[model samples]
Target: MTAQVQSAYAALRPADVVLSPDDLGGARATRHSFSRSLVRRAVAGGWDITLGRADLDEHGCGVVVFDVSAEGHRWSFVAFSQTIDESDREDRVVASSWDVTAALVDGAVDDDDVARLRPEVIRQEQGRADERTLIWTRANRSGRFFEYVVDRLADGAQPEPGVFGLSPYLLRSTAFYSNGKFGLADFERFEHGHPFAVPYRAHMLSAWLLRELGYELAERCAAARSETAVRLDGDWRRYFGLGNATGLGMVPYVVNHPEVLDAWIRLRELPLADVVARTVDRTGPDVPRVRTLLERAARYLAEQGDTEPTPYTSGAKLAAGLRPIQDLLTEYATYGTMGGAIEAQPWQHLHEAAAAAGSEVRGVVASVLTELADDLDDVVEASLTCQERRDIDPKMRCGELRGLIDADYDWLREFDFTDPTQTERFWYSSANNEEPRRAYAGVDPGERVQHAVDVARAVHALSLDLAGAEAATSVGEFLLGHPWHRGAVARVQSVRDLEYAELHANLLAGDFLPLHVQRLQLAVYGMDNYNPQSTDWLRVTLFSGAPRVADLVDGTADDDWSFTPQPSEADERTYA
Candidate 1:
């Protein structure tokens, strides 16, 4: 890391600000978000996506393909579409079928490839593919919005922007399988110099292509119905995104990938701190840009409407909280506009002011600050794509390991394992599909086979074992006598220096909220309009305000797509 980047790390917000579940859960998408970064890279690299073929019938059952070219490489998105009854459409992993199944394959797709992939892709989990396939995914049409848009367009009228009052997606992708799952290529196969070299970029790109396919399917269905059928307006087209329903499977992922989680948190927090420390020039674009972002965020929040009631924070409440922050920013902007000297570290002051409101508002402020730290993009990207490896230092003295735990794993001491509530939940894989599941310890079976997500308990146990060992004994020597501590010891030694590597909360605690962890992961993926459907699962939209295919092709893409305000009837005339 450069000296400038090191300074940013030094200024990172306190752990309470950066790692608390409440604050992390409230995170909004910033420019560094995976989806946003992918789009920016796509535009910068002059990536092109074009329709390859569409062979659908009136019922919308057929094959559709899109060819994506980036840099010197080519890939194809092969989609198999079929109409399914509403009852058959399920988001649970246990479901055996979906409305559409697709694969993002390496190189150009030919007739034989499509024919071969058709049956396999439809089989989903039971399917098999070659190493050429990068991503395997499936989606179901959004019952509430899909046909509504199709019918409206067939009737020669644009759907009202309010049609997106609940969601802007026509299809909800429930799963994206990659990284060598079910015969697909492992990440290492293409991680070096591919367009999707960054982890999960292929998945995000697949989701974006699916969004485009959804638009195409809707248009095709509409055109079949009437001669007057029209395509979606440009503004509405860009507004449409891909919906996703994530469940308990993601919770274990967050726990298992501590290094990745740490990298994401630090990348976001450090840039925010750097921006906050900068002297704000009221006469410059920074103040106005921040003000604009605040206004856009408030408008976006106000426009959000949940399909069902959720216990999590509602958009309306967030919007209400934002009013005060917006008012404060407006005052600051006005003071600068009136030739008054702006306060030093005005951005920091703004952040401090937002902190007083709550974590949600504080996160919003931090996201806006990150947006202004444009110079840190390369640093952020490098950190995200860097190889993350956790290796045990077997030669380290047991006394040193114990001290490391005491200093870095201090949060582990908060939990009392003697209490049943602290050890109530256990994570295990379901037999049906090996899907990750959480269940109560005594009431549920499979505790014996529980996954090792209880880091706090493991470290606590390791600390006790270390106390009994000789202080001068090396970790390898101690582990030989207590093999179970190897995992704990390695994790401790690996992440001791990574400040944000461990979540401070106990995953097995009775009061632990899995949705908070899920929210944090989704926020990093650049999802928006969080709607927690249950304690273990929630719905979110990707690329809601993202540029459409035409925008990218025409070089009209806008970087300022985050927190998109809802379009209105007036947009019809404005875009026209």
Candidate 2:
């Protein structure tokens, strides 16, 4: 477990792994470490239920506070849940209020602190949080599901299991505010020795705790309505998770943070490549464990519901790719035996077979790599700290810059930026709230403040600017002449050395699938059960298959939930 041993093991692994690091799923797993870090904190008793009761009535309106103190860190999560009129309930960022408004404060909170934070958190983007708050967020219930569950519980019976299974979560957080937005704590505050310093620890922790609080609220309402009402089936409760609605807002994060993005993907890829180098012990007792992991993954993919497509990919396509790969893996575990051909470079061979099968299959293979090599999580987490800074080297010659572009961004050649459809869409921030918004280019009024997420266009324009410059002209001189190309040039130079650093898409393309970008990031945040609302946004569940807070408290929590499908009622009972 030492750093040196881990490094040696990684180096001994084959360069090629279960899937390419660039493979969408493998790349996504890197971001998924949010769960790992959260679980680590949970296991270590880093969080506390300072206050469990919600002071809400039958209409489900009230306040609840959760405080956590560990590793010399202290913060309180305060949520104000209220009843909203149907007319005021909207999912878009433009909406100002929600059924629940929450904030993570920098210190333990009391009745007076909750009173002070209530109005601001409720106002959402319109309100302000001082540095004392780390994150501000809001969620609305799945109105119909909420009513049904509440009504069923009020009647002292469990809602049909199918109702919970179809849409397993009660509330969907529409927005998360952090990183100094609204004068809250900037992420840098968590740097180095900070307790929740792992990337996205604050936001992920807030969201996870919010889900647990939602469950508490629901159960409290049930108990209030009917004295005999029992808690939601423990299995059903664990099956439920927090939901998030993501939009074009997330696309810029991937583009803006090349180094951070690269860190996530690279850390994940290292484990995969390391796992690929391992010899498959087909004859050893470890075979059953490996087979069980593969089977669970296969079952999850088989049941993954369909979603409408973006230009890039769809759930149906993912399912199509997964079934055959699952069968292949199942066959390997079933019929293939000791001294099988798979042992000859087990991971490499499986990866090749998956690639030969198809892109979706390759993605699943990458997703399963971390599970196959459980030790990789520790390695990946250790690597999360100590990110290398990526400063633009402006002193490079023009020819050298072009060569770098050619080596890394030749993918731009496939794009026709001049086409109307290619430049049809634009990403912009709303002046009303400064939240990210997408619009039709030229047709939309906010194009003036459009975000610079159009990397393909930026690169294309940079190439044109560079074409007229002398070959020996330094990049610094080129930037001095055309200042607009600086950001674009910096991206080209930085991403040239980072694998899976830049998203491969034309942001302005009429058919651009921002959902893929959203999925790519959210998947890293450990979201599954994707349910798209539109081309611009989708709702996904987090911690659906994860353990409850109580489970971890008593040391019964199992870390087997990542990418694993929720079991059916029959399966749960049978296994239990």
lDDT of each: 0.83, 0.69
Which residue pairs overlap in candidate 1's backbone? Answer: none
**In model 1, what is the error at residue 536, expressed in angstroms?**
0.9
lDDT of 2 by residue, 1-576 (tens): 677446644564232221122345223333235865676666665454455446877767888887676566787889999877877777777786789999988878788888899989999878988878989989888766777767666666665644543247878778778888888887776656566677777888788888887787788887788777666674566777887767767778867877776666556567666766667655555456545655665666555445343333454456566665555545566656323443445556666677776655665675675566655555676666645454678889999988877877777886887789999988888877557877897777988778878888988899988988998999998888999988887777766756566666777888776666676677678777666667777777787767777765567667677555554555323111
- Per-residue CA lDDT of model 1 for 1-576, tens digit only, reads 888788888888766446767777767778888898889888988989889899999867899999988999899999999988999888888888889999999999889999988888999889898989989999999989999988988887777866565457898998999988999988876655566777778998999889888989998999899888888875677788899888888877767887888888876887887888887777788888888888888788777643333656566777788887777667777774221445767788788878888877887777887889888887887777644666889899999998998888777767889899999899999997568888999899999999989998999999988999999999989989999888888788877777788888888998888888887888889997777778888888999879876677899877889887777776554211
Off by over 4 Å in 2: 1-32, 45-53, 164-167, 304-323, 334-342, 385-394, 431-435, 563-567, 570-576
What C-alpha root-mean-square deviation, in Å, does candidate 2 show against the real structure?
Answer: 4.1
| Residue 148 shift from truth in candidate 1, angstroms | 1.1
RMSD of 1: 2.5
Q: TM per model?
A: 0.95, 0.87
